[model samples]
Target: MFGGSDIKIDVKKPVYELIVEHILTNYNFLHKQVSHHVDVEYSAVLTGLALGDGRIHSAFKRARISDENAGEIAKKLMDTNIVRLLKSRKQFTSWVDDERVSDKLLFTTPFMRFWFAFVAPIFKGIKEGNYDEFNQRYENKIAEFREAVFKELSNELVKISFAEEKVVETGAYWDREVELDIFAKTASKKVIVGTCRYTNSKLKKSEIAKLEELANRAKIKADVFVIVAKRGFSSELKSLKSEDIRLFTLKSFKSLL
Candidate 1:
């Protein structure tokens, strides 16, 4: 069992090491009784899960483990009680209820989140000596990348919209049909909706219009409707402000941090 910070650290350790360290720290803080039992391959998966944002499929993909190896990896993790294998394809497919895994904490972490989002998608490219395409794809999705960055700095974002009463639940929200890149709800039921735009382009009225429509449909009367853009807002959009709308650029968001 990995306990008491006995894990070795190296100067040239991959990014995954940092991810594992973060997970260990977080888990220790959350539950003092928990300990990690990990090997190289399992470590890779844990690293993937920590970086991959709770996406198990992406974590497996990033570890470069084949379908054949997946079962073995799943078995190891499950046996160790680090993660529970929900579905058994060998017999039949079925769902595992959250209640079963709640105590087990069978979920990936932020490191795995990034791994699945970036590394796993390009496994073939890495194997076939063609990573350019994969790299380009990552570059194209800079908006999502920025949003992840925002998620990391979400605490500060909440601080800016401080109120007399402290809010508890603050996180992003997304559903099957509708997805809000950033969603924050206070204990008092005040909600904030934010959208992220990556390129140098400014946000258009059309985008704002869509968000407004979505918010109304979702039945969220957001107290603050924020728009986070990389380049900034357009003059036209900025000029036509409503009571519910606020604008933020990448610089402004970082400043909040």
Candidate 2:
């Protein structure tokens, strides 16, 4: 439906406006569900809860709300698609005692993440036309912000690698002890887990050991170990590497793009 008849598009303003509109719309919906007044405690609590890489308990503490209230609101927020709750992979969770709530809640998109993080917080400044404050609060944690993109890219890479096997689970894995950035399973029940490093530095050999250590702590016997780095790997990791170690640089990701 979004086609054009040789129409030239003024891309910049439209993109920003569209994103802003979405942010405002979701904010309004959330506001309505929580309270009649738009700028109230509920929205404030939500902003505190959503705009971080933390669990429900952490968010609740950040928002200064009770666990009961936080769980209720988190459920509502998750139900409304403003955010989503991803449980730690069952492989790791099954070993834990009683399988306590080990789910991570995050915004559905980076835009929503940014919106709740920056825009929603400083909306008053924007309403008052104070661009200075808005600009000041714009914290672009590039690696943190780009995590969702990296996760999806890794998922695609897994599908490519397991084209022959029935790729079962392809997502992240985390427990109290460790967090595997990308965790997947094949039809033959083969486990594949890895991490993503989007930085200027080269991937170090220590990373391989760290992944192995974490997997060991979690009692996961990963068949394939993958590393997706922005820069290339270190010479130490390159030489005398085990066949299980697989590497992918930023250039490697371009194939999927």
Structural similarity to truth (TM-score) of each candidate: 0.52, 0.77
Q: Measure candidate 1: CA RMSD.
A: 10.6
Predicted model with the maximum lDDT: 2
Q: Which stretches of candidate 2 lie over 4 Å from their true place?
A: 1-42, 91-94, 240-243
| Candidate-wise lDDT, in order | 0.54, 0.66
What C-alpha RMSD separates each model from the true structure?
A: 10.6, 5.4
Report the Cα lDDT for residue 30, model 1: 25
Point out the worst 10-residue segment of candidate 2 by lDDT. Answer: 1-10
Per TM-score, the best of the predicted structures is 2
Candidate 1 lDDT over 4-93, as tens digits, reads 344455647654455345432344342232333445336567656544443456667777877677757776776765554322111111
* Model 1 residue-pair collision total: 17
